[model samples]
Target: MSRIGKRPVELPSGVSASMSGQTIEVKGPKGTQTFTATDDVTIAIDDSSVTVSPRGKSKRARQQWGMTRTIVANLVHGVQNTFKKELEIQGVGYRAQVQGNVLKLNLGLSHDVEFPIPEGITITAAKPTELTVEGHDLQQVGQVASNIRDWRRPEPYKGKGIRYKGEYIFQKEGKKK
Candidate 1:
């Protein structure tokens, strides 16, 4: 038995959750989000709360139980409160701009890089060096942010490149003269 799977998810006020077959929908003040769960998993919603359970006791079922519950819970939380990830651009002339459904980045390369923002995700430019990513899907948002950061990963030599805000890059000292 999975402890996490047995725990009930508390639904916030003004948030409506519905389970239909293998899918779950959460409607909240911010917006509505849906999640596709595995067939083996079952979701139940009571007054002001939701619970998840799996039919079988197999290894796969155990994994699905926890994973599906987490996904559904994230959807509910996302609709209630937006999730955000911040990124910082380091190096000279490195910056980012939002251009109507696209993110234009200038990371010291001669040519600018254009990143297309996927649906249900929003990107905002905080400062000239800071970029913010907001979305409901935790996996997708993290993947997109990682892809963008991979373009110009911070180097250990000078820690120059794009990195997540508040992330530390350990610098290696130069060789002794």
Candidate 2:
């Protein structure tokens, strides 16, 4: 049995969830997001709480029970409280700027890198060095953050380049003189 699956997810106010066939739509103050849940998992909402259950007692159903519930719970949280990913730009002249919907990144490369923002995602910079990605969908938020970080990963030598918030990088020692 899945412990998390058995627990009921309490929904916050100002969030609405609807199901149409395999797709589930969630609307909230931030924005609206939708997902296609697996057929084996069933979701129901009752009085500001969402419950997830498996269709049968099969092995696959049991295994997927908790996973499905977690996904649903995240969706509920996403709609109510926006998910954010913070990235820091290191090295001289390395910075990111938001131009309309495009993110122009200068990471010491031959040319400036332009990454187009996807729908339902917002990017904000607290400072010239820090970039924040916010969205309702967990997958989309994570993917965009990873894509930008991949452009210039932190090096062990100097720990320079873009990295996730609180991410650790072990510094390598330089050669002896």
lDDT (tens digit, per residue) of candidate 1 on 1-177? 888888888998899998777778899988888887877888888989989999888898899998888887888888877788899999988889999999999988889999999998899997878999988777778988998898899999988999999999999998998
C-alpha lDDT score of every prediction, in listed order: 0.88, 0.88
- Looking at model 1, which ten-residue stretch has the lowest summed lDDT? 75-84
lDDT of 2 by residue, 2-38 (tens): 8999998887779888878867777888777777778
Which pairs of residues collide in candidate 1?
none
Candidate 2 Cα RMSD (Å): 1.9
RMSD of every candidate to native, in Å, equals: 1.7, 1.9
The TM-score, computed over Cα atoms with residue i paired to residue i, of candidate 1 is 0.90
| Model 1 regions lying over 4 Å from their true place | 175-177
Q: What is the TM-score of each candidate against the true structure?
A: 0.90, 0.88
